[model samples]
Target: MNVPGDGGKYAWRTEIRTRRLAVPREEREREAEALAEGVAALNAHKWVCAYMPVGAEPGSIAMLDALRAVGARVLLPITAAAGPLLWAEYTDRDSLQRARFGLLEPTGATLPAAAIGWAELVLVPAMAVDRRGVRLGRGAGYYDRTLTAAREDARLVAVVRDEELVERLPEEPHDQRMGWAMTPFGGLRRLGGTEAEESSSAG
Candidate 1:
């Protein structure tokens, strides 16, 4: 489908990437620690799909461990050739090995894309996300393709830095909207979307 404002999306990506790279190492580590604390405070889900933060990403392996400490079984994504993401259970830091696109994935049996059905919470990586839940990804379309397999009741949360959560973003029909934005200092902020209403009523 035709996604309006392609130029705007690209511009946003460039700006965000530049900003992320400029973050000082000390601040990045501090933010990572805060993210772990935020996740630890949440009511643990039985199954949580999360990613290992690499480079300038705002989280650390501690976030995954926090989820585990809260009695959740965590699943990490395994990237493949241009389709929905495969999955594998996250055991410990020892289970992670470097994979394509500079990502760290679990060294275990690969689960099919449909395994997303097992998760109640999916922590997505994003360049930025808006209050309306429009997530600006890296333009690879991995999450756009994979999140379709998530359970209807699943929470799609974008993991970002505090500054990456904005008031607006360019969105397209094919883009999957996040229900929540998890930030280092901000914690979890509910976004405006169908999932938000459902989540609020459920609570």
Candidate 2:
């Protein structure tokens, strides 16, 4: 499967990464805090699948803690052998340990890839996402591969900064589309895909 790593996609990634690196430490922390509060307000979900932001990623550890405080049992992804991602329960900040691919994962029981099906919401990290729900990942295709097992009703939300949410993005058929976008400022914006269509046509 072709990941977004060449040509237009590669250029798009470079631009987003550059912008992300330019974010000051103070602003990042502030946005992260706001993200925590925003994510916590998503109380409809009890079991959530989320990722820990590393390096210049917009979110901080507080995001996961906020999810936990909302009585949601959060499941963090663990990088496994070259394939779909594995899963582990996020008990707390201390339970996370540095792991392969520069990721911090839970040092607890590893669950099967299908464990993601148990989640009502799946929060995925992205460089950028468009209004149409197209997400630009880190050229790994990890989420694309793992999301195949996500329950049909599960809300796939792309976690990105407010500015990172744009008008359009390059999308492939194999790429998993997001139903919502979670940003520090916007909190959660419904994307312009089937979800939006359904919602609009309903009322």
TM-score of each: 0.91, 0.91
TM-score of 2: 0.91
> Taking the tens digit of each residue's C-alpha lDDT, what string does model 1 give over 73-100?
9999999998999999998999999999
Quickly count the clashes in candidate 1.
0
**How accurate locally, in lDDT, is each candidate?**
0.87, 0.87
Locate the minimum summed-lDDT window of 10 residues in model 2.
194-203
Q: Write the per-residue lDDT of candidate 2 for residues 1-203, one digit (tens) a residue.
A: 12345537788888888888999999999999999988877755779999999889989889999999979999999998789999999999899999998999999999999999999999999999888889999998999999999999998889999888887888888888998888898778788755444231101
- Estimate candidate 2's alpha-carbon lDDT, on a 0 to 1 scale: 0.87
Candidate 1 wrong stretches, greater than 4 Å: 1-7, 193-203
lDDT of 1 at 40: 81
